[model samples]
Target chain A: MELICPAGTPAAYREAVEAGADAVYCGFRNDTNARNFPGLNFTTEEMGTAIAHGRARGVQTFVALNTFMRAGEEEVWYRAADDAVALGADALILADMALMDYVATTYPDQRLHVSVQASAANADAVNFLVDTFAAKRLVLPRVLTVAEIAALARQVDCELEVFAFGGLCVMAEGRCSLSSYITGQSPNMNGVCSPASHVRYREEGHDMVSELGGFTINRFGADEPAGYPTLCKGRFLIAEEDAYAFEDPVSLDVMDHLEALRAAGVSALKIEGRQRGKAYVAEVVSRLRKALSAPPAERPAQLAQLRRLSEGQRTTSGAYEKKWR
Target chain B: MQLPRPLAASINCLPLPLVQRAVALVFRQVLARHPGLFDRLGPYANRRFRFDPTDLGFSFVVYPAGPDITVYRAGKAPPASATVSGPLVTLLALLEGQIDGDAVFFSRSLSVSGDMEAMLALRNGLDDCGFDLPRDLSGLAGPFAPPLQRLAEAIRARALAGMV
Candidate 1:
């Protein structure tokens, strides 16, 4: 399986290529993509050079135009899709059906990928996108069990990509309504979830309280491993007790299930960190590259190195194993 | 984690002005080499960034708009739009894009307070700079550059090793 890495900037793109990414995925410096953070992503000229740089080194480039277009602002997304195809993207990862329809009709030969934001979980959804948009791949959201993914892979004709490491979204891909309700920004609509612009950390006594949109998201002790104040990962009053109502704030690491994913017809393993720095991209890509190339007996030691990089130095198989009640 | 006691004491004992002057010189060199470095900071370019090295003896106040940096003893540093507190080694590693900011922040080795967006923009800008302290410094160093570079590299390695 190919190793797909995220590159938020041109420098990170080169780092990913050097660290052994089979394909480097990035987006423009606009709201057309899910990672539309300020000072991140590439400009049109930067994307051209980045693609050329990666292509010269045998690395493929993927442009993500995965955000939904706002009404009357469809031209912005359309121009981006046209630019992506003109820039020679190996594939265009998209979530908006209208944009996908535009791409399919405009450039019949352009390779299309259904972004996880589309939440195309079942065979009907995946096949529908594949058959309609002629999507070459489907990035499965982190909501499925490994068994479920394998079953879906057997039923769909397009290649399947699974996130192997990085932040876990409790919401189904870009459908983060909890964040939207609080911050008025969501991945699908604004390409930001609990945006840093809305985050505020205040020192309350000995604990540090993180708030998003003026609501307390999490309060941490002096030594507790703190996480971003995304609403879904927050502590809330439930059943008259303080509890993590949704899920724990931890990263997903399916590194241990590479062979299973491969045997299940997964075509690629993705590292999800477009908002992360080049250092994270380089380290994760290099470590995963080594683990993938190592002998099965030696892979554990190689994979173990990534544990320190996981959120709060902790990782989970997410929904892959379905270990809970 | 704090710096080793002896090293911290040594740094503390040094004249604050001399250290400040040296830091300013290094900052000038970095700016010269990476002119548009802070452009990615966008609107936050004018914001003050207080890099409070929890392990070191001083805090640095950087004005990205001015491309200027002012250093002061830890508690004496002026207020800024945002403060990023971390070990000196981790801070340097982050500036050079040699360490993962999110990983270190998650593990509690780094902390950010006030104006989260400003800090985020600064971090993104620095990540794009691709800085290598020794190399960038050595370029500005005279004929004794090789030995100076080696010494800086050794010190950096030792400090980062202690951090790990």
Candidate 2:
């Protein structure tokens, strides 16, 4: 399977390529894609340069113009698509149906990969996108079990890709309203979730309270590890108990099931976190590459090295194991 | 008042101006090597970032847009948009972008306050530059570069291991 990595900057793009990525995916500096943070992402000029750099090294570059286009701001998404195609991006990971139609009708031959934001998990949805937009690949949302993925793979004609490691999203992809409910901003619509502008942390007595907007997300004791202030991972007073009602604060790590994923007809394994830095990009890419090439006997030890790197120093297989259900 | 840690008490004994001069020299060397380091932070560069070495009892207020770094004796630094406090080794490893920052932060080895976005931007900016303090400082020793880097690396390793 191809090892697709994430990069938020030109420097990280270079690091990903150097660290042995098959393809590095990123986004433009604005809200054309998700992860529209303060000092992350590349300008058109930087994108062009970065793509050229990756191309020379035999590493493909995928531009993620994955955000849904606003009603009247169709021009913004169109211009981003045009620039990405013009800059020779190996593929465009798109989510908006109208934008996909525009790219398909305008550049009939450009390879398209349906972004996870499209939420195309089933065969019909996946096949429909492939038949309609000539989509070459479909990044399955992080809601599928191994058996379900294998089942879906057999039914769809397009290539299948799955997220290997990164932050876990408890809500449905491209349909998250938890952030909007708490912070008044939709991740899919506004390209930011738990926006730092709306996040605050304060010490209260013996605990550190992390808040989103004005609502308390979670509180950690003086000696406890802190998690990000996102709504899905927040602790709530549910059923007369103080508990993590939605999901625990842990990152998704599915490296141990590489064989199952490959056998399930997966073409690529994508790492999430474009908001992360080059340090993370380089370190994870190199480690994943090493694990991919290591012998079966040594695979467990190699994969286990990544545990300390996970969020809250904990990793979960998420929906893949079907344990949560 | 006694310092909280041995590292802090030892560093607190040094003359403030001498320590300030030493830190400035290292900062100058890094900026010279990576000219576009802070430029990557964009508007976040204009904000003051304070690096507090909890073990060392000293802090650094870096105004990246001004292209200036000033050392302060612990809590004496000017107001900052963000402050990241940690052991001296943890802070240095973070600057070099060699360690997994989120892992360290999540493990509670580091603590951040003030503006989250600005701090995140600065962390990304530092990661892009790949600042290696030992190797960068080794450049100042002329013919003694190799030995200096080795010694610095040894000291850093021991410090992180709490051996020194």
Candidate 3:
């Protein structure tokens, strides 16, 4: 399977390339892409450099123009598509319906991969995208079990990419509105979830309280670990119980399922974390490269080094295993 | 302690202001080499960062000064737009993108104050800068660059073995 990786910056792109990433994905430094945190992503010139850098190393570069286009703002998304093609992006991962139509008609030859944010779960939805926009690939959402993935693989004609590692959002992408409900900013529209502007951390006695838009999300003890205040991962009081009502603070590590994923007809494994650093890109990519080529029995030992870097120092296979459902 | 460890320690032990001056010089080199990358900051070009490495027992402020980064020993004057405090290694790991910056922040290994936007801008700017210390430092020595880089890598590996 191809090792598709995330690169938030030009330096990270180089690190991913050096670390043996088959492809590195990035977005422009704007809300045009998901994972659009402040100070992240690349500029036009940097994008050109990143593409050239990856090409020189025989690694493909993919640009994500994944966010939905607001009315009257279609031109911005169109321009991003034009630039991605002009800059030699190997593929464009898109989510918005309007943008998909625009790209299919305007740049028919450019490879289009359906972003996971599109939440096209079953084979029918995947087929619709492939038939409609000529999407060359589909990034499956993190909600399907391995059996389900294998089943869908038999039905869909396009290439399939599954997220192999990084932060796990509990909700179906492009469909969740919890962030919009609380902060009035949706990942679909603004490319930000629990935006930094709405985030505030306070020290209340011995515990640290994390709030989003003045609403308490989670509180950590002085010695406990905290996470980014995304609404989906917050702890809440449900039925007189105060617990992680949505999802736990852990990352997705599916290195152990590599063979099974490949067997299930996955053409690529995507690593998340465009907000991370070069060391992260290098470490994750290099180690995964080792695991991918190593003897099957040696894979677990190779992935052990990544646990410390996992969020909250813990990891989950997520919905890849049936038990998560 | 090998070739680079003692040298790195000596540099680490330099008077705080002098160390800040040297860091300022490196920052100048990074900006000069990647002006286009830094230009992505746009309006944030004038923002200042107050970095306090508490474990290292010193602090410094870095800000853009007409296409160059200006660094000085931090003082008790007006607070900067952003202030990052952490152990020296943690800060280095954060700067190198070796770990998740938010993960470190959540783990309480690092802390930030002031304008979060400016902090984000600086973090992204530095990550995009692609400033590899060992490579840049070794390049200054001309013919000795490769050997210097090896030594520096050795010291860095030993120091950062457990950070992740």
Candidate 4:
């Protein structure tokens, strides 16, 4: 199976390919990419150079034109798709139905992958995308259990991609409006979630309080660990007891279940942090690529080393184990 | 040394204006250290402020619309143009340059009502403030902060090791 890794910049793309990623995925610096973060993403010339670099190393490249098109702004998304195809992207990962239709009709021979943001959880949704847009693969949302993934894989004709490591999204993909509610910036619309512009932190006596948009999400004592303020993973008082109302502060580590995912017909495993530095990208991809080839029995110990690399030193199988009630 | 119940109650009921004063004092200390931030922020520092709590009679409002800082109670609507509602601790964080405005707005950790242009100006102004810890504190208290910073540095070190 292919190891699909995120590359937020040209340097990251080069790092991923050199570190043994089978394919590297990235977005243009504009709103078309889901990670429309400042100081991140690539320009058209940079993408072209990155694609050339990836091709020189026998690694494939995928461009994410994954944000939903705004009204009267479809042309921006269309030009991005055209540019990706011109730059020799191995595939185009799309979320908007209109953009998908445009690409499928305009460039029938180009490979297309349905982005997980489209929330194609079942065979019907996957089949619809495949049939309508000629999507060759579908990136499954993080809402499914391993059993559900296996069942859906059996039913769907398109190839499947699952997030194997890094950040976890607690919400059903493509259905969340939490970011837009406060920041007026939608992940689906603006290609950014919990953008850095709204975060504020202050030290009060012994506690370091973290606030997002003037609201306190979590306060850490000088001794406690503090994670970034993403609304879904924040802790809140529910019925007088403080608990993570949505999800805990943990990364997803599915390295232990790689074999099961492979057997379940997943064609590619994705690593999620494109906004991360190149060193982080290189290290994780290198480790995961090694672990995938190792015999199943010997993989756990190798995977354990990745713990020191994870956020807050905690990792979960996420929705893969049906732990969500 | 036990106090009467009435006295304890009185002590607990400090004026909301006093609380706002204390927050402003701490914010002033932070601002003092980053004078360049004020020059960069320009007109945003002059905007009015409205602070409200979810509970009644606990609003601490500050209006920077005048030459001197003005503190007022919430019921009269404090002559300010913009209103931000949250705990005092969160406000201090925003004033101290500790949090990113975009992350806060997206998470709904903070809500700003009225004066959209002023809010945007304030966010950009705050960014220029540069809320990094003083060098002395970082050097002395490096071990106590979150380990992610250390881990990131370590990864960078390891990646650069033997190469340069």
Candidate 5:
């Protein structure tokens, strides 16, 4: 199986590849990719260099042209794909159907991978992309269970990729418009969601109140750890009690379940934090790489080491276990 | 000053327009320094937003909720006003000129509504107003006296010189 990793910047790309990623995915500096954080991502020239660097090391590079094309500005998405192709990316991970069509038609030889943003969970959606655009791989949504993955694998001809670690999103990957509804910024349109510009931390009385758009999401005492506030994972009042109603602030770690995933016919395992620093990329990729080679019974030890590296010191199998309530 | 819980809840839920104005005030203050940031904000500043006086916008209403200064234009449908919603920390980060609106929008850290054109316009306008940090932070220093006031005056003088 392939070890696909995120590379938000050139430095991170280098780190992931050097640390043993089979493939590294990144986006342009603009809204072309989902991890469109400021001071992160690659420029056109930087992308070319990064791709060359990866190629020299026998590691593949994938450029994300996943954002939906603007109505009158289709050229932007087109140009992004063209640039990625020009830079010699091994494949283009795409979500927008028009972009897929354009790429499939314009750059017939360039490999295409279906981004999880497409929310292609079932065999039909995966096969549709394969039949129509010839998608080489499909990054399945986080909503599926191991059994479902095994079933879907039997139904589709294409390779399957699943996120094994990092942040967990509660919404269906491509269909979420919650951020745009509140902040006018969207992952589909702008390649961003719950942007940092809207977060606020205030030292109120004995606790630090973390707010997003002036709404209190969580409050932490001085002794507690505070994570960056994203709305979906926030603690909120529902049924007269404050709790994590949508999802908890936990990272996903399925390293222990590698054997299950491999048995389920997954072709690639992806780690999700492109906006993270190089050190994080290196550590995670290296650890996962080791886990991939470890014996099935010994995987638990490696997973325990990874648990220390995850966010909030908590990890879940997420939807892969069919544990959603 | 101490209201009952029910009364406090009612009072806290002010109409959306007032919230918009308060957000506008924060934007105006932060953007006062950069004269070109608005144009740079591009399509993001084109929308308008509505908010109750107490409402900070969707950032507080949604995930990672907190006190936020929303930006939006009026005369739009509910939730469609050209508005940008984020936390005060995010606002401060933006004001420091370390962050961009596009980054915020994409990361799901900021939320928006309404007219895209108006929201973009507002963002661009504020971007144009650079941060006058020294002037804003001067109150934090000292005896609440004339020295800080004089320092603020000197900074203003330097600002005028740079503009000219």
Candidate 6:
């Protein structure tokens, strides 16, 4: 299977290519992409350099214009599409329908991939994207079981890609508004989820309390590892039991199931960490490359080496195994 | 009352190459485990990094040379083009990918000065190397890795406890 990697910056793009990524995806240094963090992403000039760098190394470079375009500021996202195509991105991964319509209409021959943020869960949703926008590939959301993926793969005309590893969001892609309710910056609209600007960490007696928009999302014991204060991954009081009401701070790593995913008609395996550093991209892509190349019997050993690198040093198969649901 | 800082200052008086060789031994083991890192950092092979750990109240320099990086504890300011300063744990956390480097840097917990490109390259290189000190050290140690890992954790916990 092709190993697609996330690159938040030009430097990380180079690192991903060197680490054996078949393709690397990034975004403009604006709200036009999902991971719009400060000191991250590439400028238009940097995008040109990155694509050139990737092409020289025989690695595909994709630009994510995946966030929803604001109603009045539609031109901002449209301009981003024009620039991405002009800069020679191998493909454009997009979620917004209006923007997809715009790109499909304006740049008819440009290769387009349905962003996971589009939440194209079922075969019909996948088909609609391909038919309406000529989307060459569907980056499926992390909500399907292996059986379901195979079923959808059998029905869809376009190639399918799945997030093989990275942070797992509990909410459905493109539909989550939890961060907006608290911080007024939704992933779909602003291209940020649980933006760092709104997050705050404090020490309360013996606990380290992580707050987002002044609401206590989680309180960790001094000994427990504290994660970023993302709303959906927080612990809360439900039924008088303090538990991870949404989801735990763990990463999704499914390297052991490459055979099953490939059999299910997965065209590419995408690692999901645009906010991560080059070290993360290099290690994840390199390990996945090793895992994919090894004999089926020897794959587990390679996967074991990745556990230490996971979030909170924990890894889960997530919805791929169906236990998360 | 102020003897610890003076004591640490005295320790910093050790020969730079001596401390560098000791650090280089451990870091070489880390790089040896991940060969892809050398390719990621091939562009900036000769860059120098000066790390100022305010919590530890000492400074050190690292020189990346091909497959291995040499570390130096400096008695005086390091002759590095780029210098990074942060709390000891924060610096360690950044290396381990425990926290986002940009987030910590923006929050003013970590600071970098001098050559921006070189600093950025080194940061990316370190990230690509994916060094988890305890985990990598344990892996290098083979059968005795677990005990060594526990000892490293103890040191980490004690060090972080004071900051909290």
Question: Candidate 2 has which clashing residue pairs, if any?
Answer: none
RMSD (CA, Å), each prediction: 1.7, 2.8, 3.7, 11.8, 12.9, 10.3
Listed in order, each prediction's TM-score against the native is 0.96, 0.93, 0.88, 0.68, 0.67, 0.73
Task: Report candidate 1's fraction of native contacts.
Answer: 0.67
The lDDT of each candidate is: 0.88, 0.85, 0.82, 0.73, 0.70, 0.78
The top-ranked prediction according to DockQ is: 1
lDDT of 4 by residue, A1-325 (tens): 8999988766568779988999999999789988886556777998999999999999999999999999998999999999999999999999999999999999999999999899989989999999999999999899998889999998988899999998788897788988777778878999888765666655577566767777888876654545556788777999999988988767799888887898899999999987665655777899898999999888887777665446544689988987546
Model 3, TM vs. native: 0.88
Residue B72, candidate 3: C-alpha displacement in angstroms = 9.0
lDDT of 2 at A9: 80
- Candidate 3 residues B81-122, lDDT tens each? 778877777787666655567667756777776666667777
- Candidate 2 lDDT over A1-325, as tens digits, reads 9999999888788889999999999999888898887777888999999999998999999999998899999999999999999999999999999999999999998999999999988988999999999999999899999999999999999899899988888678898888888777776877888887787776787577888888888988876766667888899998899999888888888888888998989999999878776777887898888888887678778767566667666789899987857
Superior by TM-score: candidate 1 or candidate 3: 1
Backbone clashes for every candidate come to 0, 0, 3, 21, 91, 3
Whichever of 3 and 5 has more lDDT, that candidate is 3
DockQ of 2: 0.44
**DockQ for candidate 6:** 0.09
- Specify the poorest-scoring 10-residue window by lDDT in model 1 chain A: A305-314
Q: Chain A TM-score for model 4, please? A: 0.97
Question: What's model 2's lDDT at B105?
Answer: 68
Choose 1 or 4, whichever is better by lDDT. 1
Worst 10-residue lDDT window for candidate 5 chain A reads A305-314
Q: Candidate 6: list runs displaced more than 4 Å.
A: B1-55, B58-164
Query: How close is chain B to the truth by TM-score, in each candidate?
Result: 0.90, 0.88, 0.79, 0.54, 0.41, 0.72
- Winner of 2 and 3 under TM-score: 2
Candidate 5 per-residue C-alpha lDDT over B1-164 given as tens digits, one digit per residue, 9 for 90 to 100: 11245754663476767755664554554444433444433444333344322223223211101222453322232553444544544554444333444434433344544443454434433332435455554444546646776776674444333110
Looking at model 4, residue B14 earns an lDDT score of 71
